[model samples]
Target chain A: MATKSVAKKQVETPDGLTEIRWHGRGGQGAVTAAKMVAELALGQHKYFQAFPEYGPERSGAPIVAFTRVSDEPIQVYAGIEHPQIVVVLDPSLLSIVDVTKGAPDDAIVLVNSEMSPTELRKHYGLEGFRYYTIAATRIAVETIRRPIPNTPMVGALTRITGLFPIENVVNFLREDFGKKFPPKVVEGNINAITRSYEEVQGE
Target chain B: MATTDRDILAVTGNEATAEAMCQIDPDVVCAYPITPQTEVVQLYAQMVADGRVASEFVTVESEHSAMSAVIGSAAGGARTMTATSSQGFALMWEVLFVAASYRLPVVMTTVNRALSGPINIHCDHSDTMGGRDTGWVQLYGENHQEAYDNCIQSVRIAESMDVRLPTMHMYDGYVISGAIGPLQMLTKDEVQQFIGPYRSINPMLDTKKPVTVGPFDGLHGWYFEHKVAQNRAMDRALQVIQDVADEYAELSGRQYGLLDPYRLEDAEIAIVVVGSTAGTTRMTVDKLRARGVKAGMVRVRAFRPFPHEAFAQALQHVKVVGVMDRADSFGAMGGPVFLEIRAALYDCDPRPQVLPFIYGLGGRDIFPDNIEQAFAQLEDVAKSKKRASSERRYLNLRAD
Candidate 1:
């Protein structure tokens, strides 16, 4: 058997499935981000599942959502216990909740903070994981003129993981926005996503 | 527009069910919003507002009124439909019997949730399992795609001349209802071509043909005989359900049946499950199979007209069977499904000692490990020829 620390550092599973967990507050569009990512993956002909874990759903209450992308159809319907990637939609949740719970030692942790990877690693004790930081909230305010960091974080995720073509996310946003929002709002969100994709930094 | 060849879309089970409702284009939809189930009606409401569907969308004050309105709409020569969950279903309990007895083909999508005492708004089978005897044709789905397919197939089953009973197809609340997954959709034209048009016969409000509905039946009346006819219709429903499922499979290439058995052939021990947990159990069965253990599963997709003959035939060869019930039967011998399965398997020559496993009450998550533990118990029962331990056991319960 592998040693405990060695096992903690090893994150590979036999199945080639990628599971992601999102940390955000209520009303921050974390669930929508999970849904959009799943939708984008489905558009690329990949099997995906996205779901939110709810608890006393009040605005600003700590929320957690999950997304799983797989080559084959996903059959397990329970909550994701060990996520390979953890996306934090709310920087303030870093202090409030244990946002890194169940993350593997080699997991990628993405956060919507203005801090650099080195600074966040020092401040939040992010020692054993690959950390990526992006100013998603600032990007959202500059583009969408709102503090909703969902779209920007999605862009940052695209860069950090390179899980799929960014064009897939752009096309999804365009089609979804065409249905719901005005052209101005749609262009703004699209720019927010694009800018965040270029601006995200990792270590 | 006809969707060509399994157009895969990301959708929650609620959205998938409501999308099917939109395609069916029912004459009337009466609904009241509740947690988990509220999204199905909310999406359908938006579709109605956007003129996407021509159904009369009735926003009722409460679930009772919602069901009552549907009953009235169904009686007035319309293809009526509705959706509800948990306490909403409990509130519709009285009207459910009336709708079933009157032979109204009212379709309902019941997102299964735990009933309220402490008032949890999470997933469980207690709500619909309580209504198992309400004379409605009940179907369970393991995921979003199944929920969508079941919703479309239900319309054809309910509206058939031989079986005019209402249908309630359920997926787990939050788990399947709120979770987004890949769902293949049939085009609106394909759904229309499959179900065809609704032609209501013996409508109460028809001017040319006068008909009386739900008059009070005295001791001398045929109320008892009406119930017998309802039972006969339910019996006939088994065949109709299979026929409709086969026809649907031909159209969409997605097949469903009375019960979905996974690797049950030549297996000594098996576990029977319902709703979304069956997906998790299937994965666990695969793991046990790889380890050279003969583990199999039988998922009861259609529970209302409890497929007794089919179940007995499936389980007759097995040495031991585990019935996983998400709802407790309280003081009964075991859970409701366990009792039913036990009764169904009584006459088998080598009768399997069916163990009762109550699990997932009040939205407790049933993981693959928990399922593996159940299979281990089933293996133990298989090894020991005599009865073991308690008659009823709870899986994944934290005793601490």
Candidate 2:
């Protein structure tokens, strides 16, 4: 029998969704960061999706990943054409790729760099959006003892978007990291998140 | 609807499937690594190494060997499983039929990928669609949650007494397999209880009832009768698939069927699709519906035992139906799915004009705009009541 009783549950979020694009080089943990943000949203009972733009994945190659978060179940699997937020994990990618290619006028653009938001805007000739900057790699090196900027960038994004509280992200990271990493490594990541959250500078 | 207490886990489709496999904890799992699909077995291997599962993890040299090993284990009266994609699936083509013909209830996850010519490793339905005739019960999943659910249900469907055929559940490579999404998971205890225990039939391992498997069929042999019996099991699978889905719904609060129809009851135009694109098509249908367009979509969840009756009944009142296929059928009128859907509607009293759409080949993107365009074309056919071109239409293809 063709059963019509099992109607697919479609929850509609009144305010739509937040779509984010992450620009990073291969091996920089762009995909991991994208997934981390989505995972954080999942903890809040928000529907989320994260995926990388698949290609010949080689180290140092420019790559992009995306995340969509909504209060409703996300049904669209298409690539994000106009992202509400764009995160640049590697500052070098800014010159190579148009990281803000499809961003709207009011989109939030976050970058991992030592430059201030104004300096980044003028240096990269980037404009028409709220630009934020943080020395994520420096923070990661100081805390996590690694140059991987993904964790710090996640911190900056959490602070910039205020999507969830900083303490909530910290607690989530503590529990998540505790399961897989040694005590020192777990504390290092927590420090990276807290440090970046404090040091991130934006308008 | 009854609901099971579930935990929401954010994971990729591969992760979800591997998690289900950990829950199923079959007697044997033989696998070879391939792009996108590599993560599933890798995770499962970790489970096996961590002593989380009691299954023997066979690290085969190749996909052919992986399928061969699973068949051997299944024939030896063990619950066996495997996973593969693209070239790996092509390598297992011969053994795929062997497992099915031998009636070994070996469950597998065929992460859909485009077959290599230019040597691409990305999502497309080509690999599995190529093996559609290999006598395996095929199920397609639209997302990670469905992929997880289907992986669990596949064990029950394939191991069912009336439908003891090898089964493969497919999800788009990289799209679902590698992408992270939300999934509500069933506990390991619930899964074990749901699928029950592995029951051996005509066991080769049983000394009291030793049976020969894969015996050569000569001109005098019952090869023809055996083929007929296999087809009969496939016919029985249509019901068994539904019954399992019904029981799964009672346990999980999520329901599935042979076909997942959306807004098709009084539609003037509809599109039939499979895999991840179904979600995109559903969103498109909703967008069109908001503007008063009678748009509908039916996602083919089970492809091998094609639901002809359900399709005919669901799409009977529609004026035009568009069938979307991600893989081409070479010189055929359209894609494999289009051919089946058009044939399914052959007996309609007031036959609706069916159009063939071939899209997303070699992992090309199929946006909502592309699906919206297809619906617009269908709406045109419905309004004019004129036969559209029989030529296969291409979505999101460059015309230069």
Give the runs in model 1 whose Cα sits over 4 Å from its true position: A1-14, B1-4
Q: Candidate 2 lDDT, tens digit per residue, B64-163?
A: 9999999999999999999999999999999999999999999999999999899988888999999999999999999999999999999999999999
Candidate 2: stretches off by over 4 Å: A1-14, B1-5
Best candidate (score: lDDT): 2
Q: Backbone clashes in each candidate structure, one number apiece? A: 0, 0
The candidates' DockQ values read 0.79, 0.70
> Can you write out model 2's per-residue Cα lDDT over A58-154, one digit (the tens) per residue?
9999999999999888888878877889999999888889887766666789999999998997898765678899999999999989999999999
DockQ of 2: 0.70
Error of 2 at B360 (Å): 1.2
The local lDDT score (0 to 100) that residue B349 gets in candidate 1 is 96
**Which residue pairs show backbone clashes in model 2?**
none
TM-score of chain B of each: 0.98, 0.98
For residues A1-203, write the lDDT of model 1, one tens digit per residue.
22344346444443868899999999889999998888878877889999999786899989999999988889888888779999999888888887767777778889989999889977876556788899998999999999899999999999888888888888888999879999999999999999999999987
* Alpha-carbon local distance difference test for all models: 0.90, 0.91
How much native contact recovery, as a fraction, does model 2 achieve?
A: 0.87
